[model samples]
Target: MFTGIVEATGEVTALDLRGGDVRLRIRANSLDLSKIQLGDSIATNGVCLTVASLLEDGYESDVSSETLSVTSVSSWHIGTKVNLERALTIDTRLGGHLVLGHVDGIGEVVHLNPDARSWCLRICAPNELAKYIAQKGSITVDGTSLTVNKVEGAEFELNIVPHTLEHTGIGSYQAGSLVNLEVDVIARYVERLLLGDSAANT
Candidate 1:
């Protein structure tokens, strides 16, 4: 699990495509990788990728075909910079909501405009995932936790302060940008409990 709090921004140094799968290497920027070991999980752009190898400046991970198909990783280029977050430990602070590093659905940025002191982004979520999103709810976008300012059908608006833009990969987003999205983990569990027997009966 992750907290959706991005520790640093890493640059994608290389990408090796093996049929449908991929091997990705990233330069870990200012992030501390001294304590990280191989087989440990790291959230990169909201996808949980295991650290396959340690590099001088960063690490490498293998992306499965299913992960490539479900998220925006397939479109990432060599120079693409990604938000990075380590998995939560028992002593880790929950600064942000609990995130599984599982990309539920990919969303598209429909509008990005400058507001008074911040920027306003309107993203269109997948129809199936839209129902789970609520106004004032938390949603992880490109590995950054953001509150939903407003929700209209399958689209939602977010107010991004200058600090957030500078800290995460969200600053580089454009209107046509594709992003990895993970809805609140609590909401999913609640829905399952409410459905209960009905879900099993089906």
Candidate 2:
């Protein structure tokens, strides 16, 4: 789990396309090497990836074919900078909210309007996931947790502060950019309750 707080920005140094998967070596620019370890799960742009090897300044992880097919990682390449977050610990402060590091689907960046102090970004998401998004509700975009400022059909707006723009990949977003998305866990349960599904049924 993560609090949606970004620790540092890491760059993809290399991606060795292994037969069925890819072994990725990431260069941590602002990532803390002290807090990382082998087998530790990290949230890379909202996708939960296990560390396969720990290097001097970065780490290596493998991305499965399914993970590539589902999320936006397929387009990723060397030099791609990504938001990095070590898995949440019991003693960690909850600055964002509960994040599973499991991205449900991809959302497209349709609008990014920059202003004096902040940026207004609008994304178009899958219609099915629309119900899970709410105005002022929690949502994770590319591993960075943010609140929904507005909602219209399959589109939602997010206000990005300077800190967010400086810390996460959303700062580099443009029209037609595809980003990973995770809806709030509580909202999922609430929707299921409203839909009449229960634990007994499943």
Candidate 3:
């Protein structure tokens, strides 16, 4: 599990396509990898990927075809900047909401405007995932946890402060940009519970 708090920003160094899957490497920037062992999980741009191999300055992970089909990873190229966060430990602080690093769907940035020292970002979520989002609720975007400022049907707005923008890849986002989105895990559980017996059938 993760807290959706980005520790550092990393860069995609290389990508090797293997038939239907991919083997990619990322430079860890300032994130500490000394304690990271092979098979440890890292949240790379909201996707929980297992460490296939450790590199001198980064690590490599294999991306399954299903992951690429459901995520924006298919658009990644060399030099792509990504949000990075190591798995949370039992002693780690819950600074953000609990995140599984399992992206539900890809969202598209529809609007981005400056709001004082911060920025207001509007993204359109997939119709199926819209029910999970609520105004003032938490949502993970590109691996960074943010509060929903507003919600309109399948669209929602977020306020990104300068600190978050500077520290994460959100600073580079623009209209039409694709982003990974993970709705609050609690919401999903609550929904399932509300469904009662019908939930099992589905």
The worst-scoring run of ten residues by lDDT in candidate 3 lies at 191-200
The number of clashing residue pairs in model 1 is 0
lDDT digits (tens) for residues 1-202 of candidate 2: 8888888889889989999798988887768878777899988888899999998879999999999988888889998889999998889999998999989899999989987899999999998899899999999998999999999999999999999998788888999999999999998877668766465586
Q: What 10-residue stretch in candidate 1 is worst by lDDT?
A: 193-202
Error of 3 at 11 (Å): 0.6
Rank candidates by TM-score, best first.
Answer: 3, 1, 2
Clashes of each: 0, 0, 0
Which candidate leads the pack in lDDT? Answer: 3
Global fold similarity of model 3 (TM-score):
0.98
- The TM-score leader among the candidates is 3
Q: Considering TM-score, which of the candidate structures 2 and 3 is the better prediction for this target?
A: 3
lDDT of 1 by residue, 1-202 (tens): 9999999999999999888789999999998998899999999999999999999999999999999999999999989999999999999999989999999999999988999989999999999999889999999998899999999999999999998888998888998999999999889889889997898985
| TM-score of candidate 1 on Cα atoms, chains taken together | 0.97
TM-score on alpha carbons, each prediction: 0.97, 0.94, 0.98
Question: Which digits, one per residue and each the tens of the lDDT, describe model 3 over residues 1-202?
Answer: 9999999999999999999899999999899999999999999999999999999999999999999999999999999999999999989999999999999999999988999999999999999999999999999999999999999999999999999999999989999999999999999999989999998799
Task: Answer with 1 or 3, whichever has the higher lDDT.
Answer: 3
